[model samples]
Target: MLQEKIGGEAAVDARALVKTFGDKRAVDGVSLTVPAGSIFGLLGPNGAGKTTTLRMLLGIIDPDSGTRSLLGHTQPLDASSEVGYLPEERGLYPAMNPREAIAFMGALRGLPLAEGRRRASVLLAERGLADWEKKPIRSLSKGMAQTVQLLGTLVHKPRLIVLDEPFSGLDAINQEKLEALIRAEAADGATVIFSTHVIAHAERLCERIAIIAGGKVAFAGAVDDARDRLRPVVRLQTRAEDGAWRAALPPGARQVGREWRFELPEGGPEPLLRALIDGGAGIDTLSIERPGLHDAFVAIAGASAAAAMGEGAPE
Candidate 1:
């Protein structure tokens, strides 16, 4: 399928990307487009080829087949200075102070060392790490070190930022802070893409998302479009017992406690309500509940992905 480009030129455009390790096909024919100035999410369970696809896009590893364009450059290395990346594995010089560490990363991306240090001071102060800026990275907590590394990713103010499993070890508070930081980046007109197995972060932060499973793209598009694949559920509780009125219930209706829960069929709830009333049922309550991203993820990615999610493996 031809990948759809958003906003004229995509920040990242990858087509038919494939990768293999020995005999195992790690990534097979994945295509994705991330619009400029948007928060795009690559979501999948562990070992679903998300990291492989990302590595290919960043020119870290060659794809067995397919092509990619990053920041309008067909060759990612040509635009390397314009992109900031945070790998799934975290690394920072244990002996370096937070300020020096951030500046060093920014310097590698072409930002002047003095300016990098200036921005680092401002960022650290704003993030409530002012007192810790002079401390060695080894002295900071895990969450603090993660935050500092993320600061490094943003210090150069690249046009595109890519992060892999960014929230892997963050506490609830740090996760919230990172979410806000991602929004702030997009707000500043920088395109952002992050890979994760967690659904909540994607649901809350991304406007568009791609779901991958078993080394292939299962679904990709707007979050709402994915959710719309499944219809809203209609839950009804009627005082009437098993009778002609019971036949008015939807085909998939099943009793859950006192309520009959089923998906709302075509033509919507009005028809269902009319059918129940016409059949002389005493309606106690009725509700139409929209499905969330979790429901969409389950429906699109299948049982195994959902099971992995339940196990907290990656999704």
Candidate 2:
């Protein structure tokens, strides 16, 4: 069980959630706790039960077993007015203008139509879409339509926001804009939960993450804790080509060009540094490299999950 931070109440709490369809167990004993006013990522490869778990959390579908709470509501729908959701499948009436579409979404969450429209106008201007506010959804580019939908999700100013695969189909510029929007929401005290197979976004944005693979939670905790599972790598460049200090190198250490690279020794780097200096091995450059989130994901969930991320996998 993860410890909740002081004064940080859980915005979403799920325990041992399981869902089955026919003979396939889509989610098995999955659990997660997202603190309020924080960004959490539900990370996994495609078909890794991310969508299924999210559905169960939102009361869109009930789990065959286990329990969940959303914003302190035992029944997720009871808190619907305080939650905003953007499903992976995007949908908007093509004939409706951006302002109307946004206002319509707000209306679904119990916001008055007139107030929704007012908020929509302000949101559009803030997002650099003021000129397109009155434009029909079909007349806008795909990216613009998606941004309008995202704005619609926020027009009601919900305390909790859930976005499923929000970055899909977006170009680099739009993706950056979405990232900024997410940050701005969190800055204003909204709890943001987004699911994606891409590790870069999670690593860059989330304070905590739950990695699901093969329909189970492979790992869930702080981002740094996940990376700490692997030892730091050491890269060294020395003035001496060969000397008594060579013995100080660990067994798996290898040399390529001018640099020698290996994992940090079990005892620490101090002893190795002392041996190198004492034996006249002049150290030109030395760097201790911490493993990144991609490496941590590969280590925790296996290379298969890493491959599932495809080109989005960090280098």
Candidate 3:
């Protein structure tokens, strides 16, 4: 598929967006750039203003003070035909069949009914939903219905896709299917930006991410850059329980059942290994590990925010 390029290389650009609802500030000074054809993530706990920020960027609502460009258009809605948005609220008319439902959604995006129907059939077959294509949405399982909606979002093969909380309420199998679908879209040169509080999905899917907390952006950049905020950790096991080599261990080192763990020393592990060898500590095993996305999120967004992610979907 030939992607319709617009507005240079960036698919999305927002600068200092702010939104207020009554006495509460829903979003504050949020800024980020999403590169075209890349998979980006908007990560945050519920009530953190991720939805509000996305709404502003999509031109669904105006920002109190900020600027945004979508697909190179200063007005995001102008690019609606090129963008596919799956909102947080998942709904389909109970009377409509999967094929009809998908086609209807595509029609809303300006796709002709015939083309949309053709694409919907292909999509259903590809997703193993061919047998259910003619079944009314009310007769399908929740996951199946959601899959139909997702296929509808893609029938037009948009250049930019924005999904808000795409993984919520999905079983493990459905979530994996959604992940594969997302990957396939990006591979076809479509830019995908999804919002999620689940760190695992973002860790696997996003090349870059914006971590929001309390209506503010705590960090935004490459996934690796975020993980690099903390030092790598060292986990070691020694044959000798105690020795002078122990003195070489860095501060904050802790021993647990014949194993020692600590942050990697500032000078690196080479010196520590030498000290262990010379002192006959008899190293059994040693390994250095970088922080994962979950750890990075906790450090960047605070433990409270991480806790909220595990609780449930945000309001």
**How does each model score on TM-score?**
0.95, 0.95, 0.95
**lDDT of candidate 2 over 1-315, digit per residue (tens):** 874752467999999999999999999999898989999999999999999999999999999999999988989999999999999999999999999999999999999999999999999998788999888899999999999999999999999999999999999999999999999999999999999988989999999999999889999989999999999988999999999889889999989899998889998989989998998889999999998899899989998888987734432
Provide the lDDT at 209 for model 1: 98
Error of 1 at 216 (Å): 0.8
Candidate 3: count of backbone clashes, pairs at least 3 residues apart or interchain: 0
| lDDT (Cα, 0-100) at 206 in candidate 2 | 95
lDDT score, candidate 1, position 254 = 86
Worst 10 residues of 1 by lDDT: 306-315
Choose the strongest candidate by lDDT. Answer: 2
Residues 1-315, model 1: lDDT tens digits? 565666677898889898989999999999998888899999989999999998899998889999999988988888889999999999999999999999999999999999999999999999889999999999999999999999999999999999999999999999999999999999999999999988999999999999999899999899999999999988889888766788777778888788888889898877888888988788999989888888899889986896785533321
The better-scoring model by lDDT among 2 and 3 is 2
Please list all clashing residue pairs in model 3, or write none if there are none: none
Q: Identify the runs in model 2 with alpha carbons over 4 angstroms from their true place.
A: 2-8, 311-315
